[model samples]
Target: MKLRDLGGVVLAVLLLAGCSTSPVTEGQAKAISSDRVYAPDLVGRADSESAKATFLRDEGYFGSGCSHVIYVNNRKAFAIRQGEGVSLRLQPGEYSFRLETGAGMCPNIATSQDITLKPGSAVTYRILLPSDGNLRLTRIQ
Candidate 1:
């Protein structure tokens, strides 16, 4: 490749990268905004003393038909489908969270994460199945 052509190629690559975003900002930005929370059947009602927790399922084709389960402090909290979300008003404390699909790669894996939520504060978690098919529970915002 010529030097001038390579410079042009590098510029193009940089511009493309700039146009994209991190994984946390990805997947239906319009729907995942803080105000647009999903509250099916008024699940997890929040009071002035409760912290808001939201979980969003990735908008991917992998495991689209499977139900994604959310465990808060080792208890079954919510089950969400693809491109869907759930909001829970939880009591603030140190919490352990885990995600399970019961299908796809590493189905029985017990990978989990922990977070400390404060009363009257809000947080969100995202469930994603990447190209490799491993399930992940990521805290986004």
Candidate 2:
């Protein structure tokens, strides 16, 4: 793609990115990710609250340019670039987590994993970026 074309695609992606609420917070992302974070909308509870689950994206530079979006229960929860991570505070339940590429110019790639969250327990999921074509979401903590 040419320079202007790539710029248009990035602009379009930025505009479309704000349409949803991300479960991850900017503060948490900054603390974990070694790269950059695109999705930072807070959709989870506070640290003082009774948090049941936490989702973190792996810190890597393989897919740094594309927005690595994390989907929880089939919804867009957050987008973490290479080296970026998110800590989410969620309620107790069974949640399906997945990874996807950002809209426009990004590859249509994805991977998913399921976990059951219990009360007074903290569950964690991790998204590993290996390439622009696909990503893996696995339980790490």
lDDT of candidate 1 over 6-105, digit per residue (tens):
9999998876554332343334532333333233333546788888877777665556656666777777666666667666777788888888777543
Over 4 Å off, model 1: 1-42, 103-106
Cα lDDT tens digits for candidate 2, 43-129: 445554445455555443345556667767887666665444556666667788777775645667777777776666766665555
- Clashes (N, CA, C under 3 Å) per candidate: 0, 4
Name the 10 consecutive residues with the lowest summed lDDT in model 2: 18-27
TM-score of each: 0.65, 0.58
The CA lDDT at 100 in model 2 is 79
**What clash pairs does model 2 have?**
33-83, 33-84, 34-83, 60-83
Per TM-score, the best of the predicted structures is 1
Indicate the TM-score of model 2: 0.58
Report the error of model 2 at residue 110, Å: 0.7
